[model samples]
Target: MRSLAYVAISVQLFVGLQCQSLPAKVKKCHYGDGKCLVESANALLRNFPKGIPEVNLKPFNVLPVRDWLLVNDSQVGGAWYFFELLNQINYGFENTTITEIRGFDKDPTATRIEIHGKIPRLVYKGDYLAKGRMLWFVDINSHGTSESDFLNFRFDLTLKVRIEYRNNKRYLKIYELVPNIRLDRWIMWLDNFFPDNEDLTIAINNLFNRNWVEFWNELEPGILSLFETVFLSLFEDLFEKVPYDDLFLADEDSK
Candidate 1:
């Protein structure tokens, strides 16, 4: 009787594993159907904030970044700057809206997917260190807490994936990810810019805010690289647990 009970438990566990394929909330799209793909992708994003336990994904609403650095040695407005941020917490991705999706209509064997999206606002809080020289005369050195609010940020994401066979099922393995990001406006505040001089700190903050475009031009590369790393990890976690066949159903399969 004990041996028979052991067999029954084993069979139950196997059946449970087989049933845990994809999250129930995920709407499977037909292969090469862009409209359905968009809807499916949006549904997936909505689930990402709370996480899909079936796929073993974690909440990504607030992502933590260790550190990032930007250096502008070349002359720009008669000033050159070096900035570094540490222990950053980026917020607001849970509010993202996918404006367009492309390359999904390509052949199933194709390896590329392009996605465009916007985040109404992104808030970053971190510790910052900055050093710079202005007008070939004035030198600036500061380190303190900083907060930046980016409004109307848009991004174009490209994902490169390859097929892999696991347990006789096909799955997508994301090998590379690239992102192009743009911001419409920025609000920045840094504490202790001049160390105990409130007036200087306020002035410096205003200057940075007013000239944010130039600053963004300098920071864009670093920002893109950061997003590439973060999103790649996020996608890998989702794709590895889900089979390709489960994600995009064929027409007959949909029926």
Candidate 2:
């Protein structure tokens, strides 16, 4: 009876020591092959949103925005450069709320990740220089005429992303990101052009309302490109901040 009692106490001590060895922040996985890696990946994602404030992006600027307002350069007699400033702009995404995170698959070849979230808004507020197009019905041409405007809007976004690990570095390639534009209190303001005219403001708003689909279609490519840039760099930075051993610490058999 004395020998059996000693064995039980020894076993308990070993278990306790093992549990205490893992870092408190990371949940250790003890069973099944690949479970540790999966859990580690999940942990990485769970910690991802916390690092958003650290992901600072250089202002994304696209010049002479392709197919902007469906107006061609030749149609304006190659005078697009002056008006290019109207389309050339800086933008960013903010208030991103991640609703779901999945795809830490056990299969090594499985490369897909699905993330669902709401981006509270896309922000654009700045100045531009444009020489007006008289033919295309744009009658304004000056330095500050088309300057100082702002836009805030929301979208329900789902991201299907592909990832690859090479040379100990991970690369994320965006597969698809579908953003459904939401109409919840969208704010659009053009400060100097039509600030006081109620009817003209409504008319302009009605124009956007009538052709919002086209507007979204025009905006999608640039928005997605900017998003991919921000997130990829975000994950890269996150990985640098988080160590591999800390994330994937596991017993040899589990690996």
Candidate 3:
């Protein structure tokens, strides 16, 4: 029954999209700025290779960010290059201005890679691919979204490369749950029907807390950041010193 209902609703949405004209060519994302999803993804992949590894010949983003560091192995700023790759890869819906760039020219530390720019988009918490095996070696996502013309046309897609290095050799492959998705119809359906569905909202919120504490711990550490930290304090470690002592008058007679 539920499956049939979903099919019915989905059909209605598709038909509605086909009938209504998309009013504009802009949409804002949690990442801020107004640009269609497909366009932003395209911008990211297209520029991935520009200032990448030393040679920049890889022409793909399959390697773990760490492994991609090797491409710049022969020069300084190799580690920074690794970060640059991520910056481009995670480009959310933001302006074309420089966001943030912090790293050593030749050497940098992991604890603090350094960051610049106003990164407003919350990182997509869940749905990471398999670790050792590069499933999304070649990610091709299409968004049939229309910011201007709403004739149910427009394709914004991206192709990302993934690879693994073993025994000093490289292996490459593609990964996807569904290789092809008709996002135009999907987004329209989601926008109208599930935008405020309680169950769906709960599911997305669950992902937010799934690793929430762990992420906070990474920012501040020690005995204070234990798994029990939630009970001990709500971000107590990050609190600034109160310095209430200064507020008191030296002449205890004011009382």
| RMSD per model, one decimal | 4.3, 13.0, 28.4
Models 1 onward score TM values of 0.80, 0.45, 0.18
In the range 52-125, model 3's lDDT, one tens digit per residue, is 23212233322111211111222232121110111112212222222332321111121222222221231111
Better of 1 and 2 by TM-score: 1
What overall lDDT goes with each candidate model? 0.78, 0.43, 0.25
Candidate with better lDDT, 1 vs 3: 1
Give candidate 1's error at residue 178 in angstroms. 2.0
Instruction: Judge candidate 1 at residue 225 and give its lDDT.
Output: 83
- Candidates ranked by TM-score: 1, 2, 3
Q: What is the C-alpha lDDT profile of model 2 across 152-212, one tens digit per residue?
A: 3444444565555533434344456555544333344433434456576457556765665
**Tens-digit lDDT track of model 1 for 15-111:** 5564346766568777667677777767777876877777766566877866887564655565888878888888887888887776643254463
Question: lDDT of candidate 1?
Answer: 0.78
Ranking under lDDT, best-scoring first?
1, 2, 3
lDDT of 2 at 240: 41
- Report clash pairs, candidate 2: none
Q: Is candidate 2 or candidate 3 better by TM-score?
A: 2
